[model samples]
Target chain A: MKLTTIAFDADDTLWHNERFFTLTQDRFADLLSAYTERDHLDERLLSAEKRNIGHYGYGIKGFVLSMVETAIEVTEEKVPAHVIREILDMGRDMLRHPIELLPHARDAVVAMAKSHHRVVLVTKGDLLDQERKLSESSLRDHFDAVEIVSEKTPDIYRRIFAEHGDGSERSMMVGNSMKSDVLPAIEAGAWGVHVPFDLAWALEHAEAPEGHDRFRVLDNLGQLAELVGEIG
Target chain B: MKLTTIAFDADDTLWHNERFFTLTQDRFADLLSAYTERDHLDERLLSAEKRNIGHYGYGIKGFVLSMVETAIEVTEEKVPAHVIREILDMGRDMLRHPIELLPHARDAVVAMAKSHHRVVLVTKGDLLDQERKLSESSLRDHFDAVEIVSEKTPDIYRRIFAEHGDGSERSMMVGNSMKSDVLPAIEAGAWGVHVPFDLAWALEHAEAPEGHDRFRVLDNLGQLAELVGEIG
Candidate 1:
């Protein structure tokens, strides 16, 4: 695969993000332990998220709302006000958390940016939260363009590539999610790089598009620049 | 003027959004009353928002973050943790606030939707928040497309119009913000309808392109469909 431009996903792929969500979820489960089992609460929240994704889209705010909804449901509408408030606080804390660059994240993107590739940050989530993280990440100056989109679908990838990158033939998306960051980019005819995060949100789980010629799975972000160099 | 499609801006254009922001800002000022005067706090917050727009983008999350940033600055980093916590509560209250439809918003968009026009919602804000509001407004089925964009510019308008609505010549945008909803649409060669909201955001304030052949200023959303019919 010969790629001219590489787009990086911000959340887990860039720095610590999903792990924060997981930590929050664990706290949420503890808060609701009296009402239901931890495993049951987890299942319920995931179900609520899947059901509400169409209505609420994606982001921490939606996740919080979904958690609140789940709390009410799990307790049969008897969830305590303080519990809801705690859930909201968890979300606020997540939003306010510092951006911690994963091992070799800066070097990987910086190396690519220094190369001929037109590096772009195409992350999806709350625009403000994503932008705030991007700003704090101190990697803003490196990208040619930054797109905080609602979703990462084939249509989205196709248009982003058309406008920002060099179209699918010469574009690649490097990220953690197979459903969001990988499959869609590959479906858009761009290379998909998977660097698995230890704790991914359950809703974002999907099997990689195995047998796709342009798909690569690296265990860590440290291998990114080398992979790109080899691809070139 | 002959219009084949009409796009409406959400937020203040369709409902009572800015008023809520104003109310929240007032509370934010009260929260920081220990450090600064209300007017001074307001100014500082706006300045912070302006400076952070590139970094935080738009929507309530950014607004809350700006309020927290302003609190920290106005207090010279001596702001109480509770004060910061209050700012986040203001944001949560906003997210939970019920959707209040603006005068004649439903009639305007529904009429255009029921007609041959490919009515689209071209509002800009957090995707989850926007979708939640859209769902709550009960106007989901009206628009042929709903774009929750990061920024509205002439280029953005031109591309959206080309893809979703009729090209510039046969399209129109109806909204309250001259900068975001009207000017850019007109600059893209589409007709722009300004239905001024009482609480126009300071950042969204801009001079409408007067003497522009397709520019129309209606007193309220009530006159929208009739205006479109008359144009036809």
Candidate 2:
């Protein structure tokens, strides 16, 4: 019953975030199909990220600016203002989206809350997008606090655990991403549980090295609740 | 016109290899859809690779055996003999495949052979599978020598260039995979050209950092011949 603090990731974790990014990207590709190549578009987006990382920050809105920049650069002076408007509107749709929690996300968070565990939501992205999502989800009440981080380094996890938890073996991290979530937590002397989700990138899905026993993989979030409950 | 040695990679560079593995995997997933999960299948295939790397070396044949081993383990000896046959058949097809050269692969190699280039086929895989592919391709005449390596390390490129081209800038490496083919060659002070192909694994597609002067990216082998001819 020692597991006290539970940390969760936000994007593609509590709600549908990446699917929107994927969909927007597909549409952007479709828009640029006549004028530019996917690789070129990707490079332009990368460039825009480099340019705006200090100003616009990161997430869908930053991606939106990059797409606009790419379109303008590729189309030269021939860029129709209407096309720019369309892309901006697309960005707006992303911002205004209703938070659709993944299956068992709400139930698990609610269960953890009722059990009086110190639940925290740790996520990386544009501050406004993360804030908008939390406000929309209405499940933010379940978490004791939320941390919108710039990156998910091991240091960040250690800092969070130290500030929020018993700073011992009672802290655990749950996430769908092995790289960003489980591995870093394990490195920070916290237990990690991995719940693999569909649409995980190939780089993110690499196998855990043999005999890495501090981590566990779950099929569903329900199983996570059961594990926490069992330990509690 | 100092380009002396030309090296080519096997697998997708010369012929079809990974697609067959992918097809077999999809079919295997279909067969085990009822009993085993896709993620479980993925985990076991990865596990088998880790387990057998010391024993079987690396390549398509090793991957096939891993698949077979995974099937048996997952099904608990209840898998039918026919199903096992199907898995074995997929492996055999890979081994028995006539090394069908990519478009302009043979013509470009022939052109280089007729020119002053010391054509070398440098590939990584199970030694037997790579040898079989070379023999089946009828490309034996095109290459003065062939190197069947276990892994494509930067050291491998350096050693090959030094041994084959007397450690001169007159050596060049050409292949479809960027991580293995181009970067290592560039890093080893040899000319490198990337011939991008469809369906490259994410691991094989690492980006070139900005401002790489010694590297070139070509759309096809035809372009590669022209670029080499121009450089020479």
* Winning candidate number (lDDT): 1
Worst 10 residues of 2 chain A by lDDT: A201-210
Q: How much is the lDDT of residue B58 in candidate 1?
A: 78
| Interface DockQ of each model | 0.15, 0.01
Model 1 lDDT per residue over B209-231, tens place: 88988899999998988888888
* Candidate 1 chain A weakest lDDT stretch, 10 residues: A77-86
For model 1, the superposed segments whose C-alpha errors exceed 4 Å read B1-122, B128-174, B178-194, B197-232
Our model 2 lands, by Cα RMSD against the true structure, at 22.7
Q: For residues B58-146, what per-residue lDDT tens digits would candidate 2 score against the true structure?
A: 56555655665677678765555445546545665665666667888888888889986888999876444565678779988888777
- For all predictions in the order shown, the interface RMSD in Å is 9.0, 26.3
Query: What is the lDDT, from 0 to 100, of the residue B131 in candidate 1?
Result: 76
Judged by DockQ cut-offs, the docking class of candidate 2 is incorrect
